[model samples]
Target: MAVVIRTANWHSERSAIRSIRDAVFVREQKVPADLEWDTLEESARHFLVFKDGEAIGTGRLTADGKIGRLALIKSARGLGYGAKLLETICEHAQTLGHQRVYLHAQQQAQGFYSRAGFIVKGDIFSEANIPHIRMVRDLDFSSG
Candidate 1:
């Protein structure tokens, strides 16, 4: 199935976006509900991935080029949906004149982000009881 991703607003897409994040981050990963959702949401750029009219993945980009709250349903993963989501966010960052993008990748997902051209930078750190590493990817501006 083909998955389409597009920019979304917090007001209109909040339910679908929060559903995916709540599933993946809060329930599945055991992250505290409070830490999973925050005030920065109102100003961030959100994106959602849909397949067959069902929301399957979601992510967000901040003004300073920080990508966060990325999640995909178990069934939607390993099918290029994550990579597509990352690419879409990176493209959006470039459009906003951002030259680099960064995200705090869970240790288990470091390899996945690496495959998407993100490089691990800092030491492993614990966030919300989960091990994570900082990863950065520079956007190619030659074509811009």
Candidate 2:
């Protein structure tokens, strides 16, 4: 299926982004309500992936260009949406003068991040009852 990935700002896309993250991270993955919902929401630039005009996945890019809270509903996994979202965020970060993009990736999703050019820089740790690792991808847009 064809999907459209777009950068989402505050006000217009918050609800859709929240609902998608709530379903994937909070409901399915059992992430604590506190971690699933945080102050970052208001300060971050969100990305929403739509299929047929439906919000199926969402992620965020922080003001400092850190990427986090990546969540994609079960129905949309493995379709390259996650990577697309990350690429979009990283590209935006490049435009914003960010040198790197970081994320605390769940252990199970480490490989996914790795495939997207992220390198694990630290040992695994627990967050919201799930094992996570600090990953970073340096964005060098100077050549382009």
Candidate 2 structure quality by residue, lDDT tens digits, 65-112: 678888888878888888888898899888888999899998999999
Worst 10 residues of 2 by lDDT: 1-10
Per-model TM against the reference: 0.96, 0.93
Best by TM-score: 1
Lowest lDDT 10-mer window, candidate 1? 135-144
TM-score: model 2 vs. ground truth: 0.93
Model 1 residue pairs with clashes: none
lDDT of each: 0.93, 0.86
- Any idea what lDDT model 2 has? 0.86
In order of listing, the candidates' clash counts read 0, 0
Please report how far candidate 2 places residue 49 from its true position, in Å.
Answer: 0.5
